[model samples]
Target chain A: MKSNLELVNDCDQFPPNRDPSFLYRFMVNGFDCPFGYLLEATVNTFSWPDYWEINHDGKTVKLLGSSLEERNKQIHDTLLAERERGSFKILKGWTSEIFSVYGPQKDLVLSIPRIAAPLFGIVTYGVQLLAYQSDTSDGAIRIWIARRAKTKRTYPSMLDSTVGGSLPTGETPFECLIRESAEEASFPEELTRTKAKACGTVNYVCRTDERGGGELGLFTPEVQFTYEMELPKDVIPTPGDNEAEEITLMRVEQIKSALGKGEFTPANGCIVLDFFIRHGIINFENEKDYIEISSRLHRTHAFPTA
Target chain B: MKSNLELVNDCDQFPPNRDPSFLYRFMVNGFDCPFGYLLEATVNTFSWPDYWEINHDGKTVKLLGSSLEERNKQIHDTLLAERERGSFKILKGWTSEIFSVYGPQKDLVLSIPRIAAPLFGIVTYGVQLLAYQSDTSDGAIRIWIARRAKTKRTYPSMLDSTVGGSLPTGETPFECLIRESAEEASFPEELTRTKAKACGTVNYVCRTDERGGGELGLFTPEVQFTYEMELPKDVIPTPGDNEAEEITLMRVEQIKSALGKGEFTPANGCIVLDFFIRHGIINFENEKDYIEISSRLHRTHAFPTA
Candidate 1:
């Protein structure tokens, strides 16, 4: 069985050989308020369009547009052109959705197409909800777990949190959670809004794997707003969309076993481990790596974040 | 009012001018497994006792002792000599307690006297418990808060968690929590052992401030094991020792006001914030720095920890 710390490290893989020299800071303001990390290959291969500036000496990339609108258009046009020419395979997964990027002052610097986020190693935000119900007789807690549909592009047929989705350009994490809960888990909006508690967040800087369906070495720094909802046993969640193939209630021990067997997606495993820690199932006496596991779930990064 | 992010930043003060060049790594096991950070001034001023070597070129400090026993003795003897000579004012607060240090592999590196830890910028561990109860009529939560005795050396007269203490060399966080619950809060050992739930941990690399009662700019990387207990309404906590001057139950709103007013110790403020976040009193919609505050509470550091 994998140790809890190993499970966390798998999600937050900071490679020992990750060379800082090959990274270009994604600068927004005149100061070094970096929002993303651009690889040397990415900087060298991309044709420098009119609004983009690359400082070779400083290893920094900046948008030269005078306004946010122009900056957004500059990225949109460049990625659209890349998709049209089939220059970068990553653009093929474009969903036409945009993600808001923030600078040091917490101002929205610009929005980038969802497919192009990993290309610049931008920080992406998401919401994940772990819906559980109590077994009143035994006083045990059982969580609602979802299995992604085999037809899904990433982590297909793998276990996931009950509800999860990326935040749209202007959506708050709470708003995103409400929408995803209804779409993915057939949960009532009122039920979710009233009961779901924003527990905390899980953060990681992961290098995209083959399962992520992206270019290798793509840096994906992510912040996942985590929530927990205790559902009445009668209000069972059914799959409401193709995102999930099936949903089931899992006891704590079963979830632990699945986590050890690597059945859940890396990010989902981290969320589950965090849930267990907060619920006092996996604790100091039971897990030797308790402190390390808890701390690693909220890893810090160099870039600016919202 | 101070924002939630500001409360977190107050505890995790990573100065902009923190220079890596002036810091020396504590090396062990033929690798760069640093257990502490040594400032240049600390390196230059300290007399190099036997079994201790300073590599000026590499900016590294290593213990040349053949075994852990010898390494422990080397540090003990050096600090004892410094104390006798009245060389460092920090030695005045020595409690004769030792804190266990760990290497990269989580192996026990060595133990250092408590007061000498910050001088070497070593990682320290502690246990903090927030005991609370629910208002039967409204279902509102009220937490037991303690004011540190004015006679206390550190953070005197400031608010603190219900039960807290530093982890001694051989004590587990759970054991320490149990002991502190009895000594600091006058709670029965059995009640604490059965009721307290290990929520998670809060980590930060903080520079010592005036209230810390140490030399300025002392790097104190800390990991606090946090736990929470739901107490029955009839059972109120009373001050059992001189560590606390008073114990009172405060509603969530009152706690928030106090937190904003900076009535709590820096570390205790962090613990309270963590409690509020976990209990859902602080949510994504209510706090603008939701993700930033949650992630910052579990800040990552370079030094090895247990």
Candidate 2:
């Protein structure tokens, strides 16, 4: 058995870890503070109440205590005082913390870093479509697919769902999906709860063109919550030009096949597909073409376990 | 189930949370760069990163980003690039985070928050001492009760295992326990792997403090790890002033009875004692005096059920 340090260090030694363009860079960092938005920060090492003075542009902020006792004491006192006074402070301040709009922020691929500080950051949430092609000639399950405009800052020329965004501060998993759906695809709020299929959070991290030492921008750990909104046979994806350029209705198999073939670099969408396949949202096993193309797109290999 | 907004708005409605006067308070507010020194500061809820902007002079440092995402992204990018380049850039500045140290600066209370952060900050790990008064009157199995100090912040003036800290950042469960033991009791390193017992993480939140709101610091989410240390009859607890002030030996029955009577304040320890009694670490049934006293201490109800 390896020491925790050894194991973490070894995992860190893996090369793909250093890749700045890696889509899931931040996932390696553990834990997160789920505020309205996800936060990725490092819990400072050392006992609490332990202070380290950092010199910024000058004015000194005394970094103070670390002991849990001290913290709990303050809380206890504050609560007690508030109880006696029958009044407590309501915290409110507009922070200059950096936040990014995901799902085609610019004309290029965009993503948030997974870890920073100690325990805070952002995560991406996306809806995964699972509409399949009906055998009936006139039976085509209308599925919405939004395309990334070439001018996007990150993940340029990629495909993604209509409703997706970086989770907002203090938004729950379900709320984020609903908000993204309305913003990106203009999906009706009614459809949010009706057809809203919460797949799961796909944990990943990535960097953006906004470079700082090429250092990873610690965003909230992203977990794309895939929601399936089954559309009428004629309903189509009408992506807002500001966020997306094209709306295409392809057979779910085609999307899967393209993804498997590595034809589309939908960084976050791949995991959503995993959810779809795992949850039987889209069945491809029986479709020979879909399976073949998928194998070609995503060359998955399974090794026998002895 | 209530909505998230409702939950957040109603958070204050719940008996106020315990922030306590631990060193982490200073760090939590924005003490940049950590070093070894106890800091003293007040606990206040600032929007996540906003706390970083707070100056020691009580002036808010101007933050670079306007939102959490922006701030986190910038920090993440910088860290990653630095890591990739194998050079850590000193964030050029200081956030006046304060903390205070009590007792021996060596190893006082195990820095559990640092450890718990990595473990999702939602889990608990604890150990229980099963002490007994064996038939060997000539030579009793001297149970080394790793005594906790009274004045040491957080659960000050209470009893805790000498070797218990929350799992630290980048530490495994066993590693945390081992580190706690070595730091607190100066237990041999080898003993970490040897006779040291792991009681496992307790999955619960404790609002056991009764400080009311006078201090604004009381609640603590703890994951306790209990260990049974067999002390040589001659070796009594000679606690260092910082972590533990004294080591008092209570008969097994005293502890069990204390637990039964709910006399113990930081109820987590009481639970551990009960576990110890049940496991024979402490023979409550046999040690009538211990039971009598401990029962007096058992002031609260049984382990709270939600």
Candidate 3:
């Protein structure tokens, strides 16, 4: 019997892949290092350090550094100079505000500026915690969301997760969660350490705006480990620093609508949506892209293992 | 204040990234296609068509064709010839047993033998319906899984979803479900059409074995549109054809163990695990990789939009 096999080439062929934005590359020296992303334009920028060279064929760029010391020194000094020249600005609300640098198989232990993390397309690790509470005995859930201070740089005035901070090197996600919870929202160290649930991670790749004289700014590959804390009805979230302007409680539907209208930071929206899926606020029957959305929340390729 | 920006350069500094196992290429007229995947060896002991040429680059191969029509004709005729020689056999109970041939954009509408799908990394699409029931008045749930006949080819005698069939070129997923349920499980078309709930879709990519010597086989990229049908407590499923040996009802825990022990077909196991998540049997609290598993079920890269 003849079967009607479908003829499908899912990766867009004609108009090119709608997203040619993110490419994976390793900076090579003594070993292959998972360096951050670089724009096609940035790769072609001339006057690279004498010890380093780049090879790219439209898709990916391999940064060939002369040595680990040469590479680290070149990147650190050059990137800092660029930032001082107003080429990059810090995302002040991001926690820990440290960068994760890696050498093949081990932590390089050299953290760059948080704002410069994306310029190199390095996988910037961070922690995000969502604190929720049920006011009534009926178990109706309410979420606590923070608003970034307008005075802060990068996505200022945008809605954010309840508590989040950059994952500094030499720190585990759970440790960062406890620290950020206490510092960002003034959560008791004990409550955050005990009640927080490890939800999941969100991975995304995107291009930075034209930062250096129209040079292809680096592509940013980001990975954030997420957590959720169900607080009692009496718990209140208070901002400890300028990382947040204010913390407010929001209903699930309100958060959903705001996310739909794109009011929250891109990453927070993803983390919140994941909470909805796990909490049973959203399911397959109600959403057509339920499976698709759920999958996007995890950065499967971001981490090597737990 | 000194921020903790730990320095880490993660990757091989001297050596290039290992495991460069797959490559992507497009087949143009008289030129080699930069398609993805490099097999360890050519499929079976058979002579390839004279018009077709394959260039090897370590692991990745470039499939060059004299023309678009030439490439299509060579693959189509060659695969069919091998199947006729008993090289590739039809997988019974598969609705659309046709392989889809694609290069760049636009479907050539050229369908190949279904058995050759995975070898070429072809993204295959199909429909699967999970017919379940809640017998007790206490809102307890039980699932229906089918066992394939021992004599069938491919994963024979393994457990599978309640109702599943390949998605042919012209048929919509809903329509395929209605037809497959009737033909495979003897379900009334009306009940399937009316009672079933559209869950979502699952996407996956897997490599297949070679068919012709040293030729590029199929790389199976599969997308299955899934549905859930909650049947009446007393309804009994009978096999309409020999595709299934028998249908058995299973509890959630039993199915989990079977999945863990690898008793079910790989695809079926994924579908059922998705069922458990939506049904609240498996969740973030119980499953550490809940988000990861849920996301892996959907081919995030497969869909252009969320």
> Could you say which candidate leads in DockQ?
1
Cα shift from native, residue A74, model 1 (Å): 0.8
> What is candidate 1's lDDT per residue for A63-116, written digit by digit as tens?
777678888888889888878887677888889789998877778788999989
Q: Interface RMSD for candidate number 1?
A: 1.2
Candidate 1 segments whose C-alpha is farther than 4 A from its true place: A15-19, A29-31, B15-19, B28-31
- Clashing residue pairs for model 1: none
- DockQ (Cα-based) for each candidate: 0.75, 0.01, 0.12
TM-score of chain A considered alone, across all candidate predictions = 0.95, 0.49, 0.78
CA deviation > 4 Å runs, candidate 2: A1-142, A205-220, A261-266, A279-306, B1-306
Question: What are the Cα lDDT values of the candidates?
Answer: 0.85, 0.36, 0.60
Model 2 per-residue lDDT tens digits across residues B92-187: 221222111111221221122221111111223333332223334654333344444665545465555444554433444456555656566665
For model 1, how does the per-residue alpha-carbon lDDT over B171-285 read when each residue is reduced to its tens digit? 8889999999999999999999999999999887788777766677878889999999999878889989999999999988899999999899888999999988887788778
lDDT of 3 by residue, B119-231 (tens): 44455667887888876565568788999889765678988998888877566567888899998889898988777767556566543333222223344556677788889
Which of candidates 1 and 3 reaches a greater TM-score? 1
Q: What does candidate 2 score on TM?
A: 0.30
